[model samples]
Target: MNPTARQYDTVIVGGGPAGLTAALALTRYRHRTLVVESPEPPRNAASRGVHGLIGLEGATPDELRARAWEELGRYGLAERLDGRVEEITPLAEGGFDVATDHEDTIWARDVILATGVTDQYPDGVEGFAACWGRTVIHCPFCVGEENADRSWAWVADDPDHLGMTATAFRAWTGDAIAIAPPWLPGADELRRSLRERGSDLVLGEITRLHHTDGDLRAVELADGTVLERQTLLWPQPQRQVPLVERLAQDHALALNDGYVTVDEGRQTSIPGLYAAGDLTGKPWEQGVVPAVTAGSAAADAIHFATLT
Candidate 1:
């Protein structure tokens, strides 16, 4: 069921860390906030732990969200709605009419968009999906520590960060190998850096992942050769949520380098429309803490803006 409020001071979409924290901050200011969360599992649901968040390290994603919900419950000003947003139509007069899959409509003076991005993985690789978040990981700061000191491979579909990313992993696993196609940019320079940094380089695409119950054992190359690897870092690209794409393309909300452009206040180009969390910044800026910080900052801006 949805909240009965016909109008709200602020309506937060996506009940992740960013949206929840935004609501929490708005509630402290005595504003009636509505939090609309999708029933779908979070983007990080497959991961085992929520790393890089201070004091809450190693906690599961669900655990972190549960704690956030528990704290949000204490604030009577915020109402939680369990449903996915279907559309957001901005009224010409002002504010917005938010529609949900449950067929409920809520009007709000301000909208905070906290929908995050979706990671795109490589296709046509056997067992790749099963090994994700286990042996096949993304950010090293999040999952590499536990899998360190074993046979490791840093494979990149794109070689833009090959030199920096591959060389930086020496501390975690000194014998890690950097793998990329031979024809990518800076290939020769990457080879020199890897050699200087005490690492090897492999030039081929991964064809298959050898694993058992998500524990990766080997990575097969297109050349039909298999290399025993306990951990793999295949840095892939990510895309914005459908809502974000729609707003950018249809409504002309500005985008900075493929992400929603926000000023210092975290409000989007559209007045009274704000965006936060992983959906608003570069891939490198994405993390639990950044999302929470962005949400809180956006709430502060909205509170002051609403006052006048």
Candidate 2:
């Protein structure tokens, strides 16, 4: 631990929606909090705007973050540091020593792992990367309203997830198609559900995407079949940030699948270590509202724990 390290009641590892919300909650409770964020582009950097947020609908990720910081500025108990957290060392005396890439060390009595996850898209899909967050989306509810009634396709890696998403997507668009990878398990029940919902199921290896200026035109199959589509919902697999992964490995924090497992209070398996947002395992529950709720809940838990 550095002798000159700054100390706070809690240190937030990520500055995304969850981190910012937790910071705000802690500051409101008069608890000293520090938010550490990297200079790299956020996961939602390419997203045009956030949806399902009550009042800030259609606001870009930058705009949302700016507004959060603006609100945080009103509270003097919260501080922001721009740097990537390299490692976290649990102090024997109780607390944590957080090391950053900038060589700054921070000490905190409690830590909130809101580092979130990174979306992993399918490889070798031309134009897919460019259209991500616009024409190529993940959640149907998030982008459903804007792209409603448009030709839509649900490209999924798993058969179960594909069937579920395809069924739900019908609420937004009637012309929903489920494009399954060749390795996806053949489930007769899933196929029946899709057909009942008037959704088409196509099994093929996706070769590439045809698009113009981030707007999707069609999905090209390996067999030279092109399915015209204006919007695509791909619930891409998400991986935890490196910081969270290190903590999971070192501290033996519980995890469900790839996401960090947390109790109802957002408390991780490790004492004094809490987590929120996308890092917590909840694929169907990914959105700004749930992230904010998790952050707020985690902060409340921390506040109560400190009192005890």
Candidate 3:
């Protein structure tokens, strides 16, 4: 039982940065669009400000969204729904029908999956759970400046993550160390670079996190060795398959590395379907600009598709 409603030119899934950006473009292109978003906001604890972003640099996540909403409203081109999209089915005429967790359905000429991915942290670190997005994080560009020159540690349960995390951390601070099993990739390069940069690498498995006065203090290892550090960049395997799989199987869309496959114009495997943002497998540090650019590209493709 899908709830039927008025048909639209495009119905976007997940109204985060990408979806909203797409809506803005659609409006400018004179295409009707709607954005579906989850009520819960993105987790951003250690985030002082979104980095590498133009115009909106130093703006909090919520602030950026608010400004985007205002811009979208000015064009009367988009609307946001605080509900979950449960399903999407292809219609016969190069269009898609979407079903939501709420009792509602929407028909559209195109669909864009701007739904983001989830980052899963390592298990069994006591205070680590609470420190996520705050003192513990993954992307250095997103949280590096605030902890510069302070005590920092890189923890990874998986041994293979050392090289990549080490490289990303080096760009942020010269004083960083890796705490994980000894089986590190590019060990020679990492050790040489770390020593040259005055960083240390400790071999052990982190067992728990310690905090003082609600501030992250240090990480405790299995051998009961406590490394005193105010900030930690921990790496964990990321699982990003929910919405992309739904779109791929149900609508015959292409997927690349857990991201919806799209062409130069942002068209997906399914002709009219498009994707952008984290789900599109672009660099995660891309805050608003990339999302907006992808959305505009998709809008142009949609317009061309309708004309032909």
RMSD of each: 2.6, 2.0, 3.2
Q: Rate the local accuracy (lDDT) of all candidates.
A: 0.84, 0.86, 0.72
Q: Model 2: residues >4 Å from true position, as ranges?
A: 1-3, 157-167, 183-197
The candidate maximizing TM-score is 2
Please report, as a residue range, the 10-residue window in candidate 3 with the lowest summed lDDT: 157-166
lDDT of 1 by residue, 1-308 (tens): 13573788899998888998899999998889999988888887878887777888999888987888888778788888998887787778888888888887788989999989888888899998888887888777767787888888888745656666556776688668878875778778777877887776778878899999989899899999899899988756788888888888778889888888998889898888999999887766887889999999999999999778
Against the true structure, candidate 1 reaches a TM-score of 0.92
lDDT of 3: 0.72
Query: Which of the two candidates, 1 or 3, achieves a greater lDDT against the reference?
Result: 1
The candidate scoring highest on lDDT is 2
For model 3, how does the per-residue alpha-carbon lDDT over 265-292 read when each residue is reduced to its tens digit? 8877776778877766644534456777
lDDT of 3 at 61: 75
Q: What's the true lDDT of residue 73 in model 3?
A: 83
For model 1, the stretches where C-alpha displacement exceeds 4 angstroms are 1-5, 157-160, 185-189
